[model samples]
Target: MARTSTKRLIAQARRALAEGNRSYALMLLREAHDGAPKDGAAAVLLARVLLVQDHPMAAIEMLAAHLARNPRSAEAARKLSDILASVTPVTFSRVDAAGLAAALRLDRVTADPLARAAGLLLAERGEAPAFTRGTDESALLIALLEAAPVREPGLELWLTARRRTALESLAGPAAEQDEALLAAMARQTWLNEGVWPVAEAERKAVDRLDPADPAHCRAAALYLPAERWCPGRDGGSDGMPKALAGLAGDIRRERHEMARADADLGPDISAADGTGDAVAAQYEANPYPRWGWVQPPLAGAVRAFLDRIAGGSGGPQPDGGWAGGPLRILIAGCGTGRQAVEAALAYAPNARLLAFDFSRASLRYAAMKARRHRLDAIRFRQADILDLPDFEPPFDRPVDLIECIGVLHHMADPFAGWRILLDRLRPGGLMYVGLYSASARRGLTALRERIAGERLAGAGIDPADTGAIREIRARLLARPEDDFERALAESADFYTLSEVRDLLFHAHERPLTLEAIGAFLEGEGLDFLHMDVRPHIAEPFAASVEGGHGESAVLDLKAWAAFERDNPDTFDGMYLFWVRKPG
Candidate 1:
């Protein structure tokens, strides 16, 4: 049980794992963890072994127990949250109410992952389960109601329907406190951007209620915008009850941060060129994604992490005399800072990251989050992709990695912006690029064309118009199941205003074919390293193309193009791939 003995056991476990003796490694890790229950390394390794052994339920249980005992263990929380987020519905079938209750107790686990677990739990149980006020499930429900910006449709439907029921039976003086159920409903309605469809009866009920009442204020939150509901009746709700202070504080912080960003955007955010200005305007109005929580990444060196994701085929191995020193990463368009924050956490002290975005508003949001997380590894700047070269002096060392996901396609000339970003990469450095696939976006393109051709209300509405987007969403929902437009309702982006605008109403978007992208890479003398794809897509494509050349088959763009041609929706979101500059 001594520390030295536990370290030796962990060393043995690593050796066993390197030799592909997973069972032996698991046994050794269990011994290490049993001796040093508080050791994060042993706990994380043991849980991972359990996951690999196809006992995710066991893994979740072990991680939850570890976190419960050692609440300061961030590694255990990260692993537990990742499992909860990635666990399939079938996997959830094994998780009983007790298992979920244990998971709900994990501190530092974000609301998104917890909501996912709770939602999947409900999905397994079929009909909505009764939630007792003091139970873990009820706590999860309240937390989701308070902070989940991402939609879990099943949970949302259940909560909204329950709210409708609560409103239908409105009784007592409006000045009285709403029951816990109505309070939770009000929080959810606000978090979802106040766009949840409301019935006329409910609106009338809110109209009839007294503004001075807590119940009335809670009920009004369901149908009215935050500004209206909290209208600063007495110099910014000085008399606001403690129960509602959190919601008011959130609204106040967002407005203040935005106003502050406008004045302090810094000198780097010079006037953008051409369509860049328009794209900037769009994001400045509403940053593409307004994320609530971030899942901390697994601890590892960036190089080793990339190698694992690259599969058996080699990752971007250092070449051209480049040393494997601390990483210098440049995030070309870090909207809202979600990706950049994850990178900052993942790379930690070993990486220097610079994340830039077109919108000062997004930079402000991203910076606020980074500061909140206490991550000084990253620096957020407001800069255009086109203006990057002018800002970076030629004598400065180039970055080892450049991440440009879902950003280039919005430019007036994507390739021009891409070339500029490419030049900033050190020789032998890797670049991660995500672009819309022309073949896969046919349905969405068709939808856009229809909207423009028919001059739908969404076509002419301002990009900042949430009401119009809500109307469009309602119309899409009303369509029959077989309707092609109705299929868009399945996207999570449909639930949020900024996401909806970015998804459908972008000022400019250009999707490219894989063939064109491959040709461009070849022309630029770059090597296609790997395509970041799900195993479901990669496995079949590898099996069909080049007779399953292990992971190397993923590097063949021709095969990917052929696979995409057959499966038009394979890359519906985007073709996210890694490429290395030739030495």
Candidate 2:
């Protein structure tokens, strides 16, 4: 029952399984399980062995037993859900389905988004989109949507922007007059895991709201947030339409109602004068990078990460910080707090998380979500990232990890902000950075230029004008100058009004090249840790790089530049990479 004994058992089990000795492996695994009865890793290993032996019923029973003990074990939950989902309809009995649903706890609003998606999908609940309507893969892909809310750390924000044209075909831009569709919109926003990006068919619906009739205000709750697509909604300096004014008031009230503290939704953070102020303002209005719950990584992926923060393998802590204490994590530019919440949930047992954004509205939404999920370790503040020197550090301790993704590129002088944060991170501490790629966005920028040239210089149809946007997308799709326009239509970012504007109308953005990234790394004196890339592409990249540039875990940006030249869409979530200051 000793910890060392359990480790030895696991090692023996893995070796036995590798040598085609299932019975020995099972015996060793059973010993490991008894040693740590609630260990999800033990359950996972045992299940893999059982499934290989065609004993799925035994596997399910084992996993369900572990899950009953460790309810929040993201690993046990995922294994159970995946097996339950994969069984043939005839073989999957009601008892099995109930077991899966119980693990998901579908009655709750914030279960693991993917698990919920898979459950609904396996249950044949939420209807499939037209593309997958008749295909056998329909269930699989629809189920993936549950897990796909935020594909990468920052993809939830920019993804929709790129897929605006394609998203129209998914679940948005419904008729305002259709009560059934409107109800679906409301359900999509609240009851569902993530926002569905609905579009109102009528632009004039905002003009028809009666200022005298309060009943008209009821529709304003869901309608106003979805109405962000409409143009001139924010241009109400004077003499705004009665219906528009009413809706605006309702939105303000709704945000206020959701506010957690007295000054929760106030402009404390946005009042700063910073390089990224303009970009911050845009997100203040419509927070980017939206996502919901996600199953944490598998236990085997990072054994220590399965529960608490552990000292990094990168060697001794450079700051010589205490080893046994919790990790220090900062979620810079934590919009609406999902990223921060994910961190809190993932590392709640052994980390202190501090999240701050320049948008109070975003923070308010994040606070509400954190409270709903009971993520208590995370602390939210209205401090600007630029004022890091001014904001009091929690515990007066240095940070071990900092995540600033899809934000720096928006700063007027992004590098300056980078320098400031770099100073705060302890030597050998890791930082996850996401920046726009120049090579990838080259064609995208050109397409945006042409789209702007056609529109009357910010006087185009309201973004709420889904019909008009669709017409524009259709026109571009029909007569695309090249593959870029077609790519936009097919992209996941082609969906919402906010997403469309983010892709095209971003006021301040500059793409970075891998060469530039290398230079930045050299200038910052940070070691490149890893670059997240598609394995399919990375496979050939590894081969090519080994032949020419040599192999390294840290990416070769010069080689990456060439790679992007050949595959421009490689950095859709931008170039997200990790780095650490020299230990």
Candidate 3:
């Protein structure tokens, strides 16, 4: 089909969906995919819808074939990889040994996407090729190992053997040739509690790596906070690229900040204002959502979801301001300004945005990022979400859209902060909230008790300190692999010391059941609007909600709760949803 024909088919598919005709929509999408098998967008859209309908393997096959034809589509390849990650158990058993072997051959850095995908799928099933001494592991393969434990239990033995094998190759001929790869592997293993002994030659190899090479810089950065090794120095420093130098400096500065006493954290951070002193102090030490955008490897896409919502194609604005003056958007608890900055750039020329965080250090870091990116579209302030009434004007002014994600749940009383945010929204204003899901976090809840009992997390220790958390996880990982390893490894937070600490350990947190959320919304007279998850996840949700009758019904908390009963991981991180005051 021609490009115009493809566009028309996609439009027709979308219409079919909007009209509650999923079968017809799928047919259209299938037609669209067949017409453009190599088009990343078409392949992903079709595969995604299939996944939502519970035909995961079918989705995988479609994407896999598409990738075979168009290996260059990172977008499509990533989609295939995600499906493989989720459906690996089924895929592992279904993939004949021959196909698995064929897939493994393509795991090289520059290999076709099919090969990389195969290696990752194998790793997810705990069958990454034996780690031979002096051999190279693709970056994707390493990520698969880190996340595999969650997908398949009892992977500690496999992961441990792989770690030891990689360690044995240290300072071997291959290490000398690709020392950066060794350093990167060591960093990953360290997070998993398998710190390879750093030989002197290995240290020298990493230290001498030139800074200008972005790839090497990333590998070296991973190795920088070595518990026993000095980064960029042995006897003296070899100059790095300007970008690397900045990052090296920031890491050191953060270490210093983490070590500072609470007294020096100032009145706002140290003193309990809205959230209790403990939570404030924890974030102040860490300065969350640790971004390295300014110096190097700027995020290719920032404020990803919000940007999509704001740039929503010719749709009704969330605030019902589709035909009116510019909208006002507020990012409550704007950690390090990631969402705030994204909102600014995304909605600019159409909406004004104000972002505030309780932690001054966090706000400062966010400001630096905005300035670095030359995004003046946002203004940052240090304020508590609970103190919304006291915020000075225009920052305090009622907003058409308020985004309070990953914040309220940490409060001593989530409802208190929630009520304040609701009051501050103009009538008919929209609010986006993210809070922990009780069902999804059952693992986290159990692990916390086990962790404390194991003497890994307890009194006299600050969970916010990356060094302390690393030691704790190291000890946890070193032990005979147990039940908790999966949750620990599955975290994106596991990629970095600070983030890992945040995920497994936090000063304050509360998870809510869907039923409770339903009650809360009812009590407050707010309307449950929508979610960002795949549509198939929401397909049956409508029929279960308070007033829902079919696909056209409003997405309600009751329906979400029902969905989560069987799909417990539906909101693994948190239930992110939009609500309105109902004009």
Which candidate has the top score in TM-score? 1
Cα error, candidate 1, residue 172 (Å) = 7.1
lDDT (0 to 1) per candidate: 0.71, 0.58, 0.58
lDDT of 3: 0.58
RMSD from true fold, candidate 3: 8.8
lDDT of 2 by residue, 1-583 (tens): 7777888899999999889999999989888997797777888888888888888767776775676566566666667756654442333232233234345543232334334333333444323331234443232333333333322212222223323332232234542342322332332322222233333443245445542343343343333443342223344425333334433454454455455442643346444464466666767655654544544433333324321222455534524333334578888888777788777766546678888777776777777767766767877777666776344556356687888887778777778778878877877777889899877788888877676567633576543354455556545445544655766654545444445557766657877778877888998787776677656657777676432555543355666777777777778768987777767
Better of 2 and 3 by TM-score: 2
Candidate with more favorable, higher lDDT: 1 or 2: 1
Worst ten-residue run, lDDT, model 2?
150-159
lDDT per residue as tens, model 1, 22-112: 9999999998998899898898899888888888878876776676567677767677777877674455544444434444445455656
Segments in model 3 whose C-alpha atoms lie over 4 Å from true places? 1-89, 92-119, 122-177, 186-236, 239-271, 290-325, 341-349, 364-376, 388-396, 438-443, 453-468, 471-495, 513-523, 530-572
TM-score of each: 0.83, 0.64, 0.62
Candidate 3: TM-score? 0.62
For model 3, state the Cα shift of residue 357 in Å: 1.4
Q: Candidate 1, clashing residue pairs?
A: none
